[model samples]
Target chain A: MTIDWNAFTPWSALAGGALIGLASALLLLANGRIAGISGILGGLLARQAGETSWRLAFTVGLLAIPSLWLLFAQLPPIHIEAGYPVLVAAGLLVGIGTRYGSGCTSGHGVCGLSRLSPRSLVATLCFMGAGFATVFAVRHLLGA
Target chain B: MNKTTITAFAAGLVFGLGLLLSGMANPEKVLAFLDLAGNWDPSLALVMAGAIAVGLPVFTWAKGRQKSLLDEPLKIPTSNDIDRPLVVGSLLFGAGWGLAGFCPGPAVVATGAGELKAVVFTLAMLVGMTAFQALQRQPQPA
Candidate 1:
């Protein structure tokens, strides 16, 4: 598949990042929540009283965002390098990891770290380091 | 909704918009960048830079304030110790990312990006998350 490198726009990334920062900031200003996915999903799973509504709403919005995008622009193509089995296994592993880690990237990297959480600092570094190592191993070492 | 939930929803919305604007929502673009041996796309780096640029200032502003706008104090994770769970979780997350070009945010965005596969991947992701919770809740042999 051919890609148009020259057409790549940094502004999109800037706008995207700005949007995230704004949303997170606004949420904090308006609601005082950290916007962590693990906590939200975990809350839903544990069925904590009175937590279900918001969790469901959050999950719904998560699903809705992409659908809204489709109205204006064409969605990109998807090519999974791994097979179904690998993908499923990978998903399970991530799910377990989030439970053990206490938060996902957004929770740690975006909200927690922004708030100066030491635990998030450690978690973020660990995950990012592991990510770099994994990419190296998969694409370089294993050649998979 | 409680403060936390409201914050999460708002954050998700902004995050979704960011992913869409940045092209991070598109898994194909991510894969192409990962296809560094062939045609490398460095656009994600710019996204990271932009996030850091914006994030740093906002955090600084928040810090200067006496208290968080939403509560008495900011909630920060206190633990700094690196433990087994930390190591394992990072490894697992990394492996998943390596196998799938998209992470949670991108995957969520991709669903809106119009890829049925992303929708499938996301549903599978949710199932995987739920299944893990179930397993953890099961009684262990003592």
Candidate 2:
């Protein structure tokens, strides 16, 4: 596969991954909780009073990061091959998967795996493998 | 206040930086890789490789540490069962990734990347996360 040299941004990617890994490590040290998005967000949905505040704050903070960045940097352009319906459906599916999986990629794939949770390992493998397969099918099989 | 939250936030910051660096926060770049026919980019593989390289060492170190901030040993799942949840969840996640070219990490990172489409994807993904929780309220067979 040919790469567009102009579009490459490996430095940013490294910085981002390092940031995520560091965050996961420090959060464990500081709060003693896994920073899995699904778990955090799910706790809010269940309306578990005291837990909701931090979760909300965490999520809000997540949204805030981008806003904060906009102060100094230019935002990237966006393009989607899928339609609104497809986008919505895909989101819904992800939501359902998170519930069933009991964690999103952050929690299971990143935090869970880091902690050496077999569940997270399986879940990460499952999700990542699925991702590889789905991309293959969509791009190669259906050519969508 | 809690150690976990502190660590999580830190990890997220780094993760966001990684996304920014990898060009993963960009939908067009991700789509190109998925394109397979057009100019396919494999830059993401390098990002994964870098992450694993760092992660492997960190994880090994953490494994040897006796007590964590939680006052207990790090919890690692022992089961290797490949159950329905694993299969179904993976399929769903992959499907979403393929269709949207956005996963949760980059969707969040995209906010910083300043992409309108990523914003939309992130909002929808949040809604979807919420919807799943709502649905789970019903008593369904485990």
Candidate topping TM-score = 1
Instruction: Give the runs in model 2 whose Cα sits over 4 Å from its true position.
Output: A1-7, A115-118, A140-144, B1-14, B35-38, B63-80, B111-116, B140-142
- Model 1 ranges off by over 4 Å: A1-8, A76-81, B1-10, B31-39, B60-75, B112-114, B138-142
Per-residue lDDT for B25-91 in model 1, tens only?
Answer: 6655665555555455667667656765666667656655545665545543557777777767756
**Model 2: per-residue lDDT, tens digit, B14-80?**
5565565566666667766655555766666565555555555666666665566656445433456
List the candidates' TM-scores in order: 0.79, 0.78
DockQ agreement of candidate 1 with the native complex:
0.44
lDDT of each: 0.65, 0.64
Best-fitting candidate, measured by DockQ?
1
